[model samples]
Target: MRIRRWSTVSVAAVMTVALAVVLWSSGAPQGGRVVGLGSVVPWGSADPRSPMAPPPVRGQAGPVVGGLSASSVGVLVVDGGRHQCSASVVASQSRRLLATAAHCVWLDGAWRVDGATFIPGYAAGEEPYGRWQVDTAYVPPAWTEANSPIEDVAADVDMAFVSVLPRDGVLPEQVLGAQGISFSTPPQVEVAALGYPALGSYDGQSLRGCVGTGAVEAFTRPESPKPSEIRSLDCDMTQGASGGPWLAGPDADSGRGQVVGVVSGGDDTHLVSPRFGPAAKQIYDAADTAALAATAPAPSPSTDPMSAQIAPRGGS
Candidate 1:
């Protein structure tokens, strides 16, 4: 199914519309230099003996209550009103970084450069912290160059970091608070995956979460040089949940933990993510540098919501 792109529609209309686009395109690409697979390295310390645990036997879906996850995680409205994805605020040097799935930013052999906006603590049709516009998106070169229709190749480098334009001279991290990110950790670590899945028994109106142990899995295709290893969780989140943060720790309430991965994709019973490692770190570093060097645009006259259709929340 072709994913709908947001058009010149009003914000109120876009929120209530049923925008269920296909998860991703899996057709042959025109042409591009497919890069050979590189050796995967851990993003931080590792322990091969990390005990393997069972999948998240319990899960919850609805509006986030109150806590770090509730405040830091948000929904992404891309290309004006065409596409929607999940994203979260990750701690960065520039204090303006967001983590999400690469497909959310790049798809169909090109970047979806129509105006992208993020709404943290989005519930139903409410925007709590306001809407922050995306400024720059950093995706792995492997994803951009690969021409194979195999989802594995794209999944290997599925992660991305985006820089958000500040609202009212305030950075996103400052507004939403940031979650710590970690890499190179052992497999089978317990984590909580959060997102706004807009498919299946879901309506993309609230945030959902799944807590489970993550296992390493490998996928190989004939056109690719080698198989790519990724992390997997037995969560039923679909579509709009792409790019949700996978937090590692024993407590899901406090929301104080390291982000080990992001929602990449899944079948009917499991969700997948690129194991956070060297490739992901590179993208994060590049986004940080770009955000630090970015110049803020001049502030424009504020739009009054009292006269507009959508109610004005926060500063959006």
Candidate 2:
């Protein structure tokens, strides 16, 4: 199913004042540590607005379709400043790129151009392998404008890819590896969405999956900034699931699911994503190609090992 987008925590269609636009229309975290990386602790009441929290990963699906058990696994955490979101490695162009939402790493407020960390296959609060530093981040041109949430579109532009310096002497494949990405024109017969939501029905620590029937929604661009022709579904998930990929094709569990939509933002009850469409397809293809162009240091072509970027300031 397609995810929804509303600026900040509220999914309403109305355009609120900039100060009130703290969250993305996708209901993303306004401020916090980037995913996977530890969030900074506050000196006072712990900043109730914080989004990251250590919780257990969901295993009910037992690594089945949409289940949270596979090598394509990784984490996305907000920064302590609550301005950006960083993602772990699933797969990459020569293991150089890390995928996430555009809103997750753009300059918004004072948090603009802030640095983040990436830890692939992280477990139990520890970087089992090593810590990788984020280098440069890329976002869509549309997101760089002032219109913002009012220009929302669940297209590829919503996605962002970044380069990183993996732990010394390691290629991405040598480490945890990466997940395959797709741009198949939406409405895949069936698919699943996965993520590690630190709130809601999720336990925060473990990964969770949800099955949903996908179909493309068509019409014209809405007056709002949200996307059109999103692959709609009815899966119930909460915050922290933002930027999760809507995968199709085969993997550890479900087979033959290609990733089409990404968790963008949602309505009062559901999450929204930029549907896989011509626009999304173009962006992803470009990002992948761009990653391939990077002169990532190649390992001595060794095998067996594990591994691992972000920014974008706050909203309103």
Candidate 3:
């Protein structure tokens, strides 16, 4: 996704107009005061509406073949189902939290609050864990107020959390199993970036991933924009993959890992994510806090941890 392109929001598809246009479609918050440092590499943004839509990532990636990890990652249905982005279930006490890019849920100066659903373990038109509706989305105050020409997006506030309504009395975490997430990101970590690529020979049905060391990319514009630092890696996961997770200490088969960042945007060769920090922790806390406030009964003693509900794709 390019910063200059005014198409949709998948790393850089900026569609600020109608729903048809707010389409590189995607979803942010948490607490720790953010700190940033990175190499200044200028990569102009792209026009996603162009027939030559940019590749989702800058490097090679393949299907997340046969892993319970893919089960936690899902297609985020938004724009009244006219558009989609990738999201994931993350560990939360309430078992109802999802981690995704803020742009996926709130964009074009407003929240994409209508008809948001998360389909976990979705592949080839199959919903392995069924579908869950998103009841609430939380964006940091900085993100909602981040519209400025100098800074295309506020790096400090690009991530968001969504709280989904239960399905058949079961929360998403109870079924899909949540990935572990941390607001205190390390200086550098090897990670596997995962998502469902919608364009560029991708059907947007299955999970795909690219692995690399994530490094911070800082922006220092001539106009002296806000101090911004975002984690980036070489990935070709492109438009539909926004809001996907960057997992460190990832299991090759189970996909269990620590989430360090969320996909935000990327140039053709690299994907970007706002560094998770104290601000992010606060937003995450807000969502988690709300889940605790709900009236749902305590989970049964038999409740387990991080388990996918249904068989994986191509399974019997």
Candidate 4:
């Protein structure tokens, strides 16, 4: 099974416009703040000859192979079915929270609010766990109010928290399970970055991943005013992989790891993510708090006459 190709051209055009806006607003360099040190995870030695090494293979990057990692990450579709970005289920008080890059949800001075659905465990056109609608998205004010797209400032707050609506009385976390989230952990942590990159060799149907040690690097664009520290690793993940999870800890395979960062952007050789910091924590706290006030009951599943008659009873 395969999902249709997403409109990469349209998204790229929009991003280009956003970049122009940022460049036009560029000014004097600003100092960046340290988010905090991340806890180091022993992921063994880095393999230089591994496929996850530098000089990534275009389009031949991440292809979902199944496991707890595949089940936790999903494609974030926007504009009523167009594949947009990647997202993951993260542990939160509401059990309905999702984490992704802020630019994925909000770009060009506006938010992509309607017709958003998260297909967890989505692979080869099969939605293993089912789809959940996004009810709300939360991003930091810094990202929303920035005059220019400062790399460091953007890296500092390039994150968003999304609230998912339940389907058939089942929350997304209940169906797909959730990964723990952490902030201010040490750098050079071993992690598994997962996503559905739609560019190059990827068709956006299957899940994909790259495992390596992630370290914080300061990035400064020629048009930008100052440098920003972003978490980076030698992964070949491309555009469609944006907003994917950077999982850490020894139990990453069992999906028992903490999400230290999200896939923000990267070149052909490396992937970058904004470090999970105080700003990200505040957004998560707000989303979890809002979830407590949502009292809507889950909608009942639709009944199909022919399928109901032929379907087996007492089965999931």
Best by lDDT: 1
Kindly give the stretch of ten consecutive residues in candidate 3 with the minimal lDDT sum: 307-316
User: Local error of candidate 2 at 78, Å?
Assistant: 4.1
Of 1 and 3, the candidate ranking higher by lDDT: 1
The lDDT per prediction is 0.63, 0.43, 0.62, 0.60
TM-score of every model versus the real structure: 0.73, 0.62, 0.73, 0.70
Instruction: Give a tens-digit lDDT track for model 1, residues 1-316.
Output: 3212211111111101111122221222212211221111112211122122222245433334457876788887764446678889999989988988877777656565457788888776667788888886777777666631323335657777877888889888887998989878896788888887765556566677777777776654345666666777766666678788888876653455778888876654667688898778877876676577657342112422121111011122
Clashes of 4: 11
Ranking by lDDT: 1, 3, 4, 2
2 versus 3: better lDDT goes to? 3
Error of 1 at 309 (Å): 38
Backbone clashes per model, in order?
Answer: 7, 65, 37, 11
Model 4 C-alpha lDDT versus the unseen true structure:
0.60
Once superposed on the true structure, which residue ranges of model 4 sit more than 4 Å away at CA?
Answer: 1-62, 147-153, 219-228, 253-256, 296-316
